[model samples]
Target: MSKGNIGVTTENIFPIIKKFLYSDHEIFLRELVSNAVDASQKMKTLSSVGEFNGELGELKVSISIDEKAKTLTISDRGVGMTAEEIEKYINQIAFSGAEEFVDKYKDDANAIIGHFGLGFYSSFMVAKKVNIITQSHKDGAKAVKWTCDGSPEYTLEEVEKEDRGTDIVLHIDEENENFLQKAEITTLLNKYCKFLPVPVVFGNKTEWKDGKEEETAEENQINDVAPLWTRTPSELKDEDYNQFYKDLYPMSEDPIFNIHLNVDYPFNLTGVLYFPKIKNNVEVQKNKIQLYSNQVFITDSVENIVPEFLTLLHGVIDSPDIPLNVSRSYLQADGNVKKISNHITKKVADRLAEIFKADRADFEAKWDSLKLFIGYGMLTEEKFYDKAQKFSLFKNTDGKYFTFDEYKDIIKENQTDKDDQLVYLYTTNVEEQHSFIEAAKNKGYDVLVMDGQLDNHFVNHLEQKFEKSRFVRVDSDVAEKLIPKESTLESQLSAGDKDDLTSVFSAQVPNGDKMNFIVAFEAMGKDSSPAIITQQEFMRRMKEMSAMQGGGGMNFYGEMPDSYQLVVNENHPIVERILADKNEAVGKEADSLRSKIESLNGKRQELEKAKEGKKEEEIEQAQKDELADVDKKISELNTKKTEVLSKFSTDNKLVSQLIDLALLSNNMLKGEALTKFVKRSIDLI
Candidate 1:
C-alpha cells in the first residue's frame, strides 16, 4: 500500500471547484457522467487498436444509489486504469487519462470526452470522500483501490475486483446530505445523462404492490443512448423526431415546424430546432432553447448560442466544438460558437425555404403563426432577411397570400404614387378598422393584415428595405390620399372659408397634446364621408417607438391625447350642402356677418401684402394700426359666425351625427362620447 498527495499545485483548488467553478452545483452530475462516458469511449479505441483482445461486454454505465448507506456509485465498463496508469493519471491533477487516450486515437474520437479533463474533481463538489475500484483489461494486471477524503492526499492499494471495469463511489457530504435522496439523484440523472451515447442505469423499476411500491429486478435505464438528432436524416421517421421533441418538452404544444441541423465541416453541430407556434405574444414564448455539449445538457438560456429572435425555438443543440468553461452556463464568444450560430441560422432559413417550395399552399396555411418569427429574424439579422425575402409571405385582408415580388407586382399599378413609390395598405384590427379597410376595398384596392405584435417594428424595417416602397395603415389616410396618383383638387371654398372650417373643427377636436391635427379640405366625391382622421406615417412611428424606448421624455406624444385630423371632405354632400344651402334666417344673419368679414379681410390682406415688400422697422406706425383694426374687425365677424354655428349645432343633429360617425370609424369615440353616439344612433334609426 502507498499513499501520497495529489499532484496539484494549488491547495485551495477543491474550494474553488465547490464555490465558483460551476454556475450551479447541479453541474456535478454532467461533469461526472461525462467522465464515465469518456472512460467507456477509451476502451472502444483500445479494442480497435488490438491492444485489449478481451471481449468488451455490456458497455452501459450504471449509476446506483444506496440511500441506506448514503453512497452513490457510478460504474462503467471501459479502459480501466492499471496500477502504473493509476499513478500517472489519478495522482496527477488536470491531466486526464482520457486525454492521452484520445490523442492516440484522434481519428476515432468523434464524441470522445476529455475536453475538460478536470471533470473528476467535480465529485468533490458533493462528496465528503470518494473511492474508485478499477481493473485494467490488460493481462497480468491487478485491480486497484484509490480513495480520497475531500483532500489532495489519497491512498492506493491492490484490491480484489471481479471484473475489468471501474466503480466510483461518492460518500455524500453531511452539508449536502440532500444528494442521498432518491428523488434528487433521479432529477440530476434525468437532466444530465438523458442523451448520453452509452446506456446508463439509475435504479430498479418500481411498481405499486400491496398499496406500496416495491423494486423490480428490471433496472431502469435512464438514458436513450442515441437521440434522434444524432442519427442520419434518411434513417429517421417523423415519429422519431416528434418523440424526441416530446422528450425535450413534454408539456409544450406540438411545434409548428422543425429545422434539423447536421453539419460536420467548418464545425461539428447537430440538433433539432423547432419553430413553436408563437401564436400572438412572442415575448412571452422565449428561453426554450436547450444547449448541450456531447449530450450533456448545459443550459436553456442559449441567447449567446442562438440569435436573440430565434430564442423562441424549443429543442436541443449539441456541439462538442462549443468550448465551455467549468460552469458551461456562460459560453465564451469563441470562433466555434460564432460558426455554430451562423450554421444554425443558415439551416433554419434553408429548411423554411424548402418547406415553402415543396408545398406553398400548406406553408401559407401556417403563415399566420410563423410570420412573426420570420419577420423578427428579417428585421434583426441582415443575412436572415436576405434569405427570408424569398419565402417570407404577406397575408392580405381577403385571406390571400403573396410573396415579396408577388405583392409588389400586385400593387404596382394602382397603389403607386406620383413619386413611383409603392404604397402597401395594411390594417391592424380588422373589426376596429373595418370601415377604413372596407373603404379602401371599395376602391378595388387590397389591404394587408399587419396585426402581429412585431408588425409595428417590422413595418418600419420593410420601409427601409424595400426601395420606393411605403407601408401605410389602412386608416393612415383617406383612400385617395393613400396612393395619391392624381393632382390637386379645385375647392369652391376660398382660403378664408378654409380657415373658418379649420378653426371650428380644430377647437372641437381633442387638445393638450404634442400631436397637432391639421384640418384640410379635399374635393372627394359627394358620397364620401364628411370627415376622416388620419396620421402621418413618420411622426406616428416616432411616437410609437417613443413609447417603447428612452423614456417618457418623448412620452408627451405617447401619453398626450391622440390628435386626429378632422379632414372635412368639402365636396361631400353634407359639407357641400352646408356650403351651398343658404343658412335660412341663419343664412341672412351669416351673410350680414360675411359682408363685414369680406370688408375686414380686404383691409387685412392689403395691409399684409403691402408689408411683405417692406422691411420690418421701415413700416409706418399707421400701417400697424390699420393691420390691428383689420384683425379686430375679423375677430368680431368670427365671433358672430361661431354664435350662429353654435345655435345651429344645438338644433341640427346632422352635424353631431357626422362628427360621431368619424369618431366611431377612428375607434376613438369612447366613454361619454361613445354613449352619446350610441343613444343618438338609436334615436336616428
Candidate 2:
C-alpha cells in the first residue's frame, strides 16, 4: 500500500468540484456512466485491432445499490487500469485517461464522451469516500484498488480482485443516501445511459406474476444502446419515428411533421426534430428541444445551441461540435454552435419547402398547427425568414390557403393602394371581426386570418420583408380606405357639421379601461355602416410587440392607452340623418357663435399679417393687444360652439347607439355597456 497527495494545483480541488463543478449534483451519474461506456467501447476497439489477445467477455455495465450497507457500486467490464496505470491516471489531475486512450486509438475508437479528467472526481459530490477496484486485461497485470476520501489524500494498493474490469464503489454520504435506493439509481441510469453503446443493467428484471411484481434472473438493462436517431434514416419508418417521439414526450400530442437531420461535413450532427402542435403562445412550448452529444443527454434548455425560435420544436439534437464545459451542464458560446443553429434553420425550412412542394394540400391541411412554428422562425431568424417565405401559407377568410408569392399574385392586382403599396388586410378573430371580414369580402378584397399570438409581430416582420407592402387588420380602417384604389368622395359635411359629428360621436364613445376613441369622418358610401371602429396599424403593432418582447424602450407604448379611431361614414343614410338631427338641435346657437368667431378670427388675421414681416420693435403694442383680444374672443366663441354641440350630442340616444354598435362589432362592447346597447337598440327600433 502507498499513500500520496493528488497531483492537483490546489488542495481544495475536491471542494470546488463538489460545490461548483456541476450545476446539478445528479449529473455525477451521467459523467460516471459515460466514462464507463467510453472504457467499454475502447476495450472492444483494442480487441478488434489486435492490441489485446483475449476472449472478449460480455461487456456490460452494472449498477448495484445496497441500502443496508449504504453503498452504491457501478461495475463495468472494460479496459480496467493496472496498479501502474492507476498510479499515473488516478493521481494525475486534469489529465484525462480517456483522452490519451482516444488519441492512441483515434482511428478505430467509438465516440469518446470524456475529455476532461473530472468525471471520476464527480463521485466526491455525492459520496464521503470512493473506491476503485480495477484489473487490467494485459497479461500478468496486477489488480489495483484505489481509495480516496473527500480530501487530497488517497491510497493505491495491489489487491487480489476477480475479473478484468473496473468497479467504482461509492460509500453513500448521510446527505446523499438517496443514491442507495434502487428507484433512484434506476432513474439516473435511464436518463444518462439509456442510449449508451453498451448495455447498462441496474438490477434484476421484474415480472408481474401471482398478482405482484417478482424479481427475475434476467438482467434489467436500462439502456436501448441504439436510439432511433442513432440509426440511418432509410431504416426508419414513420412508426419508428413516432414511437421514438412518444418515448421522448409521453403525454405530448402527435407532431405535425418531422425533419431528420444528418450532417457530417463541417460538423457531425445527427438527430430528429419534430414539429409539435405548438399552442398560440410560443413561450409556453419552449425548452422542449433536448440537446445531446454522441448519444449522452446534455440539456433540454438548448436556447443557446438552437436558434431562439427553434426552441419551440420538440425533439433531440445531437452534435459533437457543440462545445461543453467540464460539467456539460451549460454550453459555451462557440461559432460551431451558431453554425449548427443556422444549419438547423436551413434544414427545417427545406423540410417545410419539400412538404409544401410535394403535397401542398396536405401541407395546407396541417398549416393551422404548423403556422405558429414557421411564423416564429421567420420572425426571429433572418435566414430562416428568407427560406420560410417560399413555403409559408397565407390563408384567406374563405378557408383558402396560398403561398406568399401565390397570395401576393392573387391580391396584387386589386389590393394595391393609390400609393402602389400592396395592402394585406388581416383579422385577428374571425368570429369577433366577422363584420369587418365580411365588409372586406364585399369589396372583393381578401382578408387573412392572422389570429396567432405571434401574428402581430409576424405581420410587422412581413412588412419589412415584403417589398412596398403593408399589413393592416381588416378592422384597422374602413374597407374602401384599406386598399384605396381611387380618390375617395369628399365629405359633404361642412366644417361646423364635421365638428358637430366629431363632438357627438366622441362624447358617446365607451370609457373603458385604457381605451381612447378619436372621431373622424370618411365618405365611405351610403351603403357603408354608419360608424366603424378601427385601430391605427403602426401604433397598435408597436403596443402588441412591446407586450410580447416585454421591454427595451417599448414599454412606453405598452403603458399608453389603446387608441381607436371611430370612423363615421359621412355618406351613410343613418350618419346623414344623425348629422341633420344634430344640426337641427344646435343650428341657431351654432350660427350665432360661428359669426362671432369668424369676426374675431378676421380681425386677428389682419393684425397677425401686419406683424409678420416686421421687426420686434417695428410692431405696434396696440396691434399686439388687439390681436390678443381678438384671439380671446375667438377662443370663447369656439368654446360656446362646443358647449352647444356637446349638449346636443349628450341628449341624442342614436349617437350612443351608433358608438355601441361599432364597439359590439369589434368585440369591444361587453358587460353593462353591451346590455345598455341592447336596450337602446331595441328602443330605437
Model 1 global lDDT (CA atoms, 0 to 1)? 0.81
lDDT of 1 by residue, 81-114 (tens): 7878877877776676666766777787636755
- Model 2: weakest 10-residue lDDT segment is 503-512
lDDT tens string, model 2, 1-685? 9988888888989999899999888899888888888889888998999998899889988888878878888889899998878777878877899889888888898888887888888899999999999999888999989999989899988899878889999998999888887788888777777787789888789999999999999989888888888899999899998999999899988888788999998999999999998777777899998788888888888989888988989999888779999989789988998888889988888888988899989999999999988888887788988888888889888899988889989998989988999999999989998999999999888899999988887887888878999988888889878887776577788887787677677678875679888888888877889999999988888898899878568999999899999999988888888888976777877878888887888888778888888999998898888878888888888877887888888888988888888888888988998898888888888
- Each model's number of backbone clashes? 1, 0
lDDT of 1 at 663: 74
TM-score of each: 0.91, 0.94
lDDT of each structure? 0.81, 0.87
Enumerate residue pairs that collide in model 1.
583-587
Candidate 1: count of backbone clashes, pairs at least 3 residues apart or interchain: 1
Candidate 1 — which residues are off by over 4 angstroms?
Answer: 507-518, 548-557, 578-582, 585-647
